[model samples]
Target: MKIGELARRTGLSASRIRFYEASGLIEARRLGNGYRDYPEDAVQRLEVITCGQQAGFSLEEMRALTLEPTGGANRHERLLASLKGKVVEIEAMQARLAQSRTHLLALIAGIEGKPVDISCEENAQRLLARLRENDEPHSQAT
Candidate 1:
C-alpha cells in the first residue's frame, strides 16, 4: 500500500507517518516510479507505535522495543526490567504529587481559617510567614 493509504489506515497524518519513518520506527520501500510502498504489516507496526506513545514511551524507547532485535532468550527479561523500572518511576511521581496535594490543602486551610476581622494584607503576611517557616529546616530531636 501507499503512504497515504497507510496514514488513513493508521488514523495518523501523512507527515507523522513520514516522520516515524525518518525516526527509524518504520520502513518503506521506494518503487521505480518514486512512490513509497509499505507492507501490510506496517499498519500493525504503526498501531504498536501509537500505543507505546500513548503509554508514555518516548520515540527512542519505542524504537528500541520495536526495532532492536533482542536475542530470543533475554527478551522477556529485558522487557520485564524495563516495565518494572517504569512502575518505580511512576510510583515516585505519585508520591511527590500526593505530598504536593497535602501541602496545598494545608495552605488552603490556613488561609480559610484566618480570623474574619483580619485584613487581606494581614492574611497575606501570615501566609508568607507560614511559607517561610515551612522552608526552614527543623532540628531533629534525638
Candidate 2:
C-alpha cells in the first residue's frame, strides 16, 4: 500500500506515519516515483505500536517488548523482571498521585476558605515541585 492508504487505514496522518518510520518504529520501501510503499504488515505493526503507546510504553521500550529474536531461552525471565519492576513503579506512582490529589484538594479548600498568608502562585510552585519530584525516571529532556 502507498503511504496515503496506510495513513487512512491507520487513522493516523501521513506525516505521523513518516515520523514513525524515521523513528525506526515503522519500515517502508520506496516506490518507482520515490513515494513510500508500505507492506501489508506495516498496518498491523502500526496498530501494535499505537496500542503500546496508549499503554505508556515509549517507542524504545515498545521495541524491546516486541523483540522476536531467534528463540532466546531467557526471554521469559527478562520480560518477567521488566514487568515486575514496572508494576512496582506503577504502584509507587499511584500512591504519589493519590497524595497529590489530596494535596490539591486541601489547597482548593484552603483557597476557598480565604487562607490569610497563602497565595495561588506559592501553592502552584509547591504543587509543580511535588509533581516533578514524583514523576518517574527523572527525565533530562525537560
Candidate 3:
C-alpha cells in the first residue's frame, strides 16, 4: 500500500514511517514509478517497533530482537546490562516514593496533633535520611 494508507492504518504519520524506514526499523520497496510499496505486514511491524520503543527498547535493540538473531554478540550483554540498570533505577524510584509517603503521613499526623513547624522539619529530615539509606543498596548494586 501507499505511505499515506500505511500511516492511516497504523495511526502514525507518513514522515514517521519514512523516518523509521530510514532508521532501518522498517523496510519498503521502491516501485518502478519511484513510489514506495509496503507489505500489509508493515503496519503490524510498525506497531511492534513503536511498542518496543515505549517499553524502553532502543531502536538497535528492537532491530536485533525483531529483525534477526542476536548471535551472542555484545548486544545480548548490553541488553542485560541495560535491564539491570533499569531495575536499579526502578528500585531507587520506589525508595523515593516510599520516603515521600512516609513524610506525607508524618506531616499529616503532626498537623493533626498540632505539632510545631520545627518538629515537622525534623520529621521530614528523618524521613529523607531513611530514603537515602534505602536507596544506597540499589545504587551500590548498580
- Could you give candidate 3's per-residue lDDT for residues 33-138 as a string of tens digits? 9999999989988998888788667888778666765466776776677668767877898999998898678657645665355576676676667556755767
Q: In angstroms, give how far residue 29 of model 2 lies from its true place.
A: 1.1
**Regions of model 2 farther than 4 Å from truth:** 70-84, 114-142
What are the Cα lDDT values of the candidates? Answer: 0.86, 0.79, 0.80
RMSD for each of the candidates: 2.5, 8.1, 6.3
| Residue 57's lDDT in candidate 1 | 78
Question: Ten residues in a row with the worst lDDT in model 1?
Answer: 133-142
lDDT of 1 by residue, 11-127 (tens): 999999999999988899999999999999899989988987886678988887888684675777777776787778789999999978977897798788988999878987888
Q: How accurate is candidate 1 locally (lDDT)?
A: 0.86
Each candidate structure's TM-score, on Cα atoms with residue i matched to residue i, is 0.80, 0.68, 0.55
Higher TM-score: candidate 1 or 2? Answer: 1
Ranking of all candidate structures by their lDDT, best first: 1, 3, 2
Model 2, 1-142: lDDT tens per residue? 9998999999999999998899877789898899888999889889978887886678887677665553576777776776787778789999999988987786676556654576877766765665566565767657
How high a TM-score does candidate 3 get?
A: 0.55
Lowest lDDT 10-mer window, candidate 2?
Answer: 64-73
Which pairs clash (backbone N, Cα, C closer than 3 Å) in model 3?
Answer: none
